[model samples]
Target: MAIEIENKDQQHPRAKKDGEVVERLLQESANDNNLAEVARLRIRYGGFPGARSMQRNLDIVLERWNLTEEGLFELTRQIHAEGRAYKRNSNGEEQEDWT
Candidate 1:
């Protein structure tokens, strides 16, 4: 498990009791390589009820995992260009543009 080496005693206690659950959601999402979903859920449940941890760590995770908004956008663009994540709808909206 990942933990702050300096905070092994849990002295920091930066997160709420329920924070671990939310973090678990993020961790499981990350474990499955669903960084996009992780980011999205952080935006969704993060601002909704039942959320414990603040959304700031999304940036931390992104920075730690080297995931940035620009990076994800470029990745989406590339995937779309490669026909891996783009399907034009009947309307002008995008089918599955995660960015």
Candidate 2:
């Protein structure tokens, strides 16, 4: 599923750059087998209605990485059950560890 910006001229340069960064991070995390980070990224941007471009970029990343969102969530849930998952505080900051 290739996601191309419908109107390249209408998209802000910064947004495009940020999307690229997200793509890179997702790819790196996938390559490193960092399921936790991948899950984090999904939580951060999945279904984010505020940014259509980012959402499209995320879909592209998932397809390129050969990952399904459902599978990622299942693995993440298992990780959480094992007590090896990171938690986010009310401030949306990642805690050092679940402990």
Which candidate number would show the highest lDDT if scored against the true structure? 2
Q: Rate the local accuracy (lDDT) of all candidates.
A: 0.49, 0.62
lDDT of 1 by residue, 1-99 (tens): 887555232322324533554465545433322444444445444444333334555555566666776775555555546655534578955544233
Instruction: Say what the RMSD of model 1 is.
Output: 12.3
Lowest summed-lDDT stretch of 10 residues in model 2?
7-16
Model 2 stretches with alpha carbons more than 4 Å out: 1-23, 29-33, 86-99
**Which clashing pairs does model 2 show?**
none
- Cα RMSDs of all predictions? 12.3, 9.0
Tell me the TM-score of model 2: 0.49
Provide the lDDT at 85 for model 2.
67
